[model samples]
Target chain A: GAGVSQSPSNKVTEKGKDVELRCDPISGHTALYWYRQSLGQGLEFLIYFQGNSAPDKSGLPSDRFSAERTGGSVSTLTIQRTQQEDSAVYLCASSILTGEGAFFGQGTRLTVV
Target chain B: AQSVAQPEDQVNVAEGNPLTVKCTYSVSGNPYLFWYVQYPNRGLQFLLKYITGDNLVKGSYGFEAEFNKSQTSFHLKKPSALVSDSALYFCAVSKGPGYSSASKIIFGSGTRLSIRP
Candidate 1:
C-alpha cells in the first residue's frame, strides 16, 4: 500500500465487549509498532514487531491487551473485556528497518462506553 | 532509561514570526532525536531527525531542529511561522545500542503550536 492503513477509523463498543483493530503497513517495512493515545496524552508505546520475531510485548498495559502480526505485513490489536478507561486512539506505524523513521497510520478511535 | 520532555504546553506565534518548540531529552549515551507534527484528527508526520553529523538538521515542510548535546536538547525551529503550521508537535528520543537494550523511541507530552495570523 502507499501508506499505513488502519481499519474502523472510529469504533464505539460497550464495556466488557471485545474489539479488534487492524493495521496494514507499507510494503516492505520490517518494523511495526503499536501505540495508544488517550485524550490530551502523548503516544504510549504498546508493542513492536521486528521481521516476524517474537513481538516485544513489554508495553502492553494489561493482560487484556494483545496484538499479533501475520506475515510481517498486517497486524491486529485485540482488547478483551474492554473497559471505559480503554477509550482512546490506537495508532500503528511501520519503518523500513530498525532505527529508521516510521510512517504512521491515521489511527483507530475506540470509544468504550 | 531514555525519555523526552516538551516543556511548553502551548506556544502562540504571529504569522511570519520565528517559532520555537522546546524539547529536552535524557539518555545514557548519544541520543537519536526526532520531531513530529500532528494536525487535528490526523496521524503524526515526521518533521526531522538528528542522528549524527551536523547539529542542524532540516526536514519536511520547511522544518528544522538543532541538536545540542551539551544542553541535552533538540529544539524544533522555523524562521518564519505560518498559520498552516498550527498543530501539536512532539519530541522523541530513542536509545541506541550504545545506550540501552531498548530501541523503541519514547515521545514527550507534546506542545501545541498555534500560529496567529
Candidate 2:
C-alpha cells in the first residue's frame, strides 16, 4: 500500500459487544503504533510494536483492550465488552524505524452506543 | 520516561501573520522531536523532526521547529499563516536515534491552531 490503511472507516457497535479494528501498514515498515482519540481529546497511546513483538504495552487503558501485529505488517486492535466511553477514533501508524516520523492511517471511528 | 506537553489548548492567528505552537518535552536520553498536523476529518500528517543536528528543522508546508536542548522545547513556527494551515497540531518526542528499541514516541495534548481570515 502507498500509505497506512485501516478497515471499516466507521463502526457502530452496541454496548458490551466486541469490536475488532484492523491496520495494514506500508510495506517494509518495522514499527507500528496504536492510539485512541476521543471527541475533543488528545491521542491516547495504546501500544507500540517493533516488528511482530510489542515491547511497549504500558499505554493500554485496561485488560479489555489488546492488540497484536503479525508478520510485522498488518495489526489488529480488539476491544472487548465495549462501553460508551470506548467510542473514539482508533488510529494506527507505521514508521520505517523506531525514531522516524510515522505515517498514520485514516483511522477507524468506533462508536459504541 | 518520555513525555510531551502542549500548554495551550488553542491558538488564534490572523491569516498571513506569523504563528507559533508551543511544545516541551522530557526524556531520559537524547530526544527526537516531531511536529504533526491533523486537518479536519483526516489523519495526522508528519511535518518535521529533530533527530541529530541543526536545531532549526524545516518540513512540509513551510513549517519549521527549533530544538532547544536546554529548555527541552521544540516549538513549531511559520512565517505566514494560511487559512488552510488551521488545524490540530501535535508535538511528539522519542528517546534516541533511529532504530533504537526504546524510542517509543509520546505525543502531547494537541494544540488547535485557528487562522482567521
Candidate 3:
C-alpha cells in the first residue's frame, strides 16, 4: 500500500462489548505502533512491534486491552468489555526502522456508548 | 525513561506573523526529537526530526525546528503563519542512536496552533 491503512473508520459499540481495530502497515516497514487519542488530546502509546522481536506492551492501559501483530504486517488491537472511556480515535503508524519518522493512518474513531 | 512536554495548551498567531510552538524533552540517552501536525479529521503528519546533526532542521510546509541540547527543547517555528497552518501539533522524543528494539516514540500532550487573518 502507498500508506498505513486502518479499518472501520468509525465504530459505535455498546459498553461491555468487545471491539477489534485493525491496522495494515506500509509494506516492508520493520516497525509498527498503536496509539490512542482522545478528542482534541495527545496520543497515548499502546504497543510497539519491531521486526521479530518481542513487542513492547508497557504502554497498554489495562489487562482488558491487548494486541497482536501477525506475520509482521497486519495488527489487531482488541479491547475487551469496552467502557465509555474507550471512546476515542485509535491511530496506527509504521516506519522503516525505529529511529526514522513514522507514517500514520487516518485512525479509527471508536464510540462506546 | 524518555518523555516530552508541550507546556502551552494552545497558541494564537496572526497571519503573516512568525510563530513558535514550544517543546521540551527529557531522556537518559541521546534524544531523537520530532514534530508532527494534525489537521481536523486527519492523521498526524510528520514535520521534522532532529537525530544528530545541525541544530536547525527544515521540514515540509516551510516549517523548521531547532534542537537545543542544552535547553532540552525542540521548538517548531515558521517564518510566516498562514491560516492553513492552524492545527494540533505534537512533540515526540525517543532515545536512540539507531535500531533499538526497546525504543519507542513518546508524545507530548499536544498544543493547538491557531492562525487568524
Candidates 1 onward: DockQ, in order: 0.57, 0.76, 0.81
DockQ agreement of candidate 1 with the native complex: 0.57
Candidate 2 residue pairs in backbone clash = none
A38-79: candidate 3 lDDT, tens digit per residue: 999999999999888899999999999999999999999999
Give the Cα RMSD of candidate 1.
1.7
lDDT of 3 by residue, B14-77 (tens): 9999999999999987888899999998899998898887999999999999999899999999
Best by TM-score: 3
**Order of quality (DockQ):** 3, 2, 1
**By summed lDDT, which 10 consecutive residues of candidate 1 chain B come out lowest?**
B95-104
What CAPRI class is candidate 3?
A: high
Clashing pairs in 1: none
Backbone clash count for every predicted candidate, in the order shown: 0, 0, 0
lDDT of residue A50 for candidate 1: 81
The C-alpha stretches of model 1 lying farther than 4 A from their native spots are B97-102
Model 2 spans > 4 angstroms off? B98-100
Tens-digit lDDT string for candidate 2 (A1-113): 99999988999999999999999999998988999999867888999998745459999999999998877779999999999999999999999875678899999999999
